[model samples]
Target: MSEVPQARRTCRRCVLPESPPDITMDSEGLCSVCLEAQSSKPQPEEELLESDFTRLLGKHRGKQKHDCLVMCSGGKDSTASLYYMRKRYHLNPLAFTFDHGFETEGALRNVHKAVEKLDVDFLFYRSTFMRDMFAKIVTSGSGAILCHLCSMWYMQVALDIAARYDIPLVIAGWTKGQSAHQGTPSNGAGQAGNREYASMSEATRRFLATLKQDPKYRDFPQSMEEVLKRARRRHKAIVLSPHWFLDTHPDEYVELIRRELDWEYPDLSYPAKSTNCSLNFLAMHLSLKHYGYTHYHVEQSKLIRANQQTREEALKDLEFNCPREFLASLAGRLGIELPE
Candidate 1:
């Protein structure tokens, strides 16, 4: 992908590319997001430690058939999380992966290999249930975010399975950028609580209202808040990610997984080094066009602010490269043409 889309100017201070209204650069080359963050008062931040994580894990370790259910995406962060759960923390985890028909072959392969090597019980669930919903978003020109909708659905899956299996913990691979509640005990409301997601969160909530009008999705929750609120009553699975507590540079874990579990990067992915589903290309396309940024930009921006990643590294990793032809092919899978 090009360093920056020619039409949009990027903030000099951060990696967020400008899109009017939502993100804009000032005369000084700083984007509105950076300015907003700068003007805000610094809150008392909590320091998390590996020992704290170990203590939390000890709360329910060996209490059930599986001490936790680790959501493995086969990406570096997630794969390494799976390895650490089994090897580092000495926890028996049920490895869970859900594919909505667009997951890459290499990503699935990585999950298979990691589970086998770790000797964890693996559950691979694949379905085309989401194809119709994605098709509607493309064909009908709905302003809904594909990723946001899928996140709700996927979280429901994670909750249901954990509750069914009576697992006490739900392990994800999220970094600090991915979860604001990281390191702190949370009641399960996630990224939706972040200021950066406010506008996009509203859009997704509107889309969910429309989704609920349909017979197939009439029971769908109207927002992330609704999803979590309902989940809290039925299950007590506290979600956690090892990366949240471990300050190890992501590069270190990537190398460790590759050397230990024979992990390999996928041949094709947007944002270098990621192994996300192929459908994410379309999700990101809609996100950038409608909201000026994707969730990765939001996450990477947080990393830059936190000093976990440099601005240059965030820009390089977040460089988007989905060509029109490739997007058309991905869209065609849902029997819809690419957006004009």
Candidate 2:
């Protein structure tokens, strides 16, 4: 196991630590997951290009005023995606954002700025529908990952909105490390078959299995798989991300958004410089306490393994800088006492 200080033992070669059955460390300090990956010969897919994005957009273009429904988080990746859709690809996109009552003021402001600068139709959905569920997870000490739940909710919302508007493409801000597709949370966090999310996903599934028994959440979808399955029956919309097609580094896009959209980073976030929700603090703390690392750790570690990021940078970004008292306060808002 790595002796490094991350408030837990981590793999020597990667940031992920000894979250057993899913992640484990050998005598050499390397993680078991990495070991398995090393032994397997995996095939790499073709790198997506701007032309590919253009071609895909062309397939659904002129069908409506908006060619795609851009899931703008008001973050750099999403803002840049909106910019590219408007300026580079010359495709009209319906900018969409949703807040389940935990969004930061800066994130919302960033979204508004990007939408205004792009001159596109914007749709903002704010609701506290999931607030009770969040509270239930905390108060009951459920093992479900908050981000996974939120992604499933928002993805269903995005698909519903796309279907209603007759738009055919759903644009997301996800990078390569974030997920394989928008249907799953970052890096298959809700995908039970994904070995990377093995233990984590199982816990989420268990919690969801129990959550489904409740009359309040009885109709809730069990997984991202279920959400996507239902959407496929009604919507022909295709989900994609600009970052996947573009080879541009995040730093470059951050600069572009800063100049064009007048974008600024959120003052508070789990991973530095990224725009995430306030509930993310509670999620991070719980994930760390329960699983030893958050999904951000998994994403950054993937980036490092892919040579897109360094371990040093990933560590710094995933470091828990918040005080325990503040995290407890966040839980208090949800009407629960944070576990020690």
Candidate 3:
């Protein structure tokens, strides 16, 4: 009895696996995405400097009770953002965490330590509103990306929190790959025009379309574009990431947070070395079952292209090493049984 083989073919230039809905490999083992990226006209890049970040902070500082609303996911990127907001930049930020019942204890612990050490105000919102939606994605086999929908929901929540506090800036721990221009759409709509996000965005849109038929989820924004529109009507806040303006790498900041804030990595996560929620294990498994790859592949590929990380390093981190029993445990929580 031999074990079943997983999809192993991948693009030579990036970590994208050979998947049909969006990716195809050439004879040379390069993917269509890589080829198109190579041929596309390079857009003029905006160089963000530390001075720009300082200036922006100064302008927004002391305008309200808090200078900014920092979204802390208990991940290294976000935890570091919270640390910097209070200590390095000298801004009084309101630390916000949204738990859809899938957040890991490790992540929450990191957040708890950071807020206590920094002595900043903290807001923790936990709800089951998204639990049904996530379960639907799994049972219905909608092939929708869970992370995309989750991001949309949380982004809206973050915007509302910022507005309630009259904060001018909604800060995120997004790396260079996740950062978008301020005042743009929240869930990667600004990047929809880019070739890399086109297919994935379309898939997410199609899944959201189906949601409109359900009475409970009918009002769900169909796209990040729509999310931004609603946000503008309710409140105006600029979304920013300190990582976009700072040249510091995760290696540098991970150490900083560990030493200064007592932040530690989680025991379990996909693609290795990341600090994702417990639900992320299920999400990555389903994503691979449907799309042959996950959003992490897209993010790491971008980092490789930007020279922030090497292809070899990204490849190593992108490996799917989750054990069967661990996945079953996560699925058991969702009341779904994994296929034998």
Per-candidate Cα lDDT values, in order, are: 0.80, 0.81, 0.81
Comparing 1 with 3 on lDDT, the higher-scoring candidate is: 3
Model 1 clash pairs are none
Residue range with the least summed lDDT across 10 consecutive positions in model 1: 179-188
lDDT of candidate 2 over 1-340, digit per residue (tens): 1112455568877789887767878888888767876787764956888888788888888988789999988878888989999999899899999998888999999999998988899999998888788888777777678888888989899999999988999999888645523223333444543566666676777778888778888887887777888899997788888888878988898999899889999999979878899899888877877778777787777677777788988888887878777888788888778775
Prediction 1 global C-alpha lDDT? 0.80
**Could you tell me which 10 consecutive residues in candidate 3 have the lowest summed lDDT?**
180-189
In order of lDDT, best first, we have 3, 2, 1
Q: Which tens-of-lDDT digit does each residue in 269-324 have in candidate 3?
A: 76698888888878888777777777788878767766778899997887777787
RMSD of 1: 3.3
Which pairs of residues collide in candidate 3?
none
lDDT of 3: 0.81
Q: What is the TM-score of each candidate against the true structure?
A: 0.91, 0.93, 0.91
Residue 9 shift from truth in candidate 3, angstroms: 2.2
Off by over 4 Å in 2: 1-8, 180-193
Superposed Cα deviation of residue 283, candidate 1 (Å): 0.9
Clashes of each: 0, 0, 0
